[model samples]
Target: MAQSWQRSYADMKVRDLEFMVGERVLLKVSPMNGVMRFGKKGKLSPRYIGSFEIVKSIGEVLYQLALPSGLSCVHPVFHISILKKYHQGGAHVIQWDSMLLDQKLTFEEVTILDRPIQNSRSKDIASVKV
Candidate 1:
């Protein structure tokens, strides 16, 4: 009975969402995953990529996306928590670009935007901005 009550409490905090086939959604990329590729001093990196089309909804909380050729190695299916339904004219936007991903799903950094040096008591640290 306690387990059932706990399950219900957890479910109550989660929003019930369902995506339809052909809908566009943004896929989230966490800092730990994407930060290494772009040397941005680990700051100002985008947390999500794409307004990719939803190919199919897998059960209730997972959806398959039509990812680009560069991300072919990545599994198309993702959990609902990592996805946000694309809203028309919303602030979150990206100029769609072809990104190359390795087998490990890490992307190549295209350009270096800026580089700044940080001075510490022990040593001077150089940080690359992408």
Candidate 2:
């Protein structure tokens, strides 16, 4: 049927991510609807929060992560759509203890160590040097 073909077409783009016990995975940070609105520069903000270890796969599309003690209030299980396998050599490892994440999994403003203001086209643009 047309609906079956449509489902297959959609499924083609989706990867069946499988995680085993003790494997590490990154938890995607989806923006909260009410409190913090993702502004104009859409892709500027960070996407994933962890490199957190996967405790186990609860179901075909659900995973349990080994979250830190600081995130005791947060739920452990997450859908596969919001999870990505953590490659050992993929990117920089985050210090989970130092990061401040709210209940909505939104991170606080990153500290700007050095910011230089540059004037361009009658506008002052502040460049952050992290």
lDDT of 1 at 101: 53
Would you give me the overall lDDT of model 1? 0.74
> Each prediction's TM-score against the native?
0.62, 0.68
| Candidate 2 backbone collisions, by pair | none
**Candidate 1 per-residue lDDT over residues 46-123, each given as its tens digit:** 556788999988888889899887677778888888898788885776543655556543454657788899999999
- Tell me how far candidate 2 lies from the true structure as C-alpha RMSD in angstroms: 4.2
Candidate 1 TM-score versus the reference: 0.62
lDDT at residue 110 of model 2 (Cα atoms): 51
> Candidate 2, overall lDDT?
0.74
Tens-place lDDT per residue, model 2, 1-130, is 9999999999999776788889888877664443341221355655666789888888798888989899876788899888877877866545556766667776655556999999999899999875
TM-score of 2: 0.68
- Model 1 regions more than 4 Å off: 1-13, 31-37, 41-43, 96-98, 103-105, 108-130
lDDT measured at residue 11 in model 1 versus the true structure, 0 to 100: 92
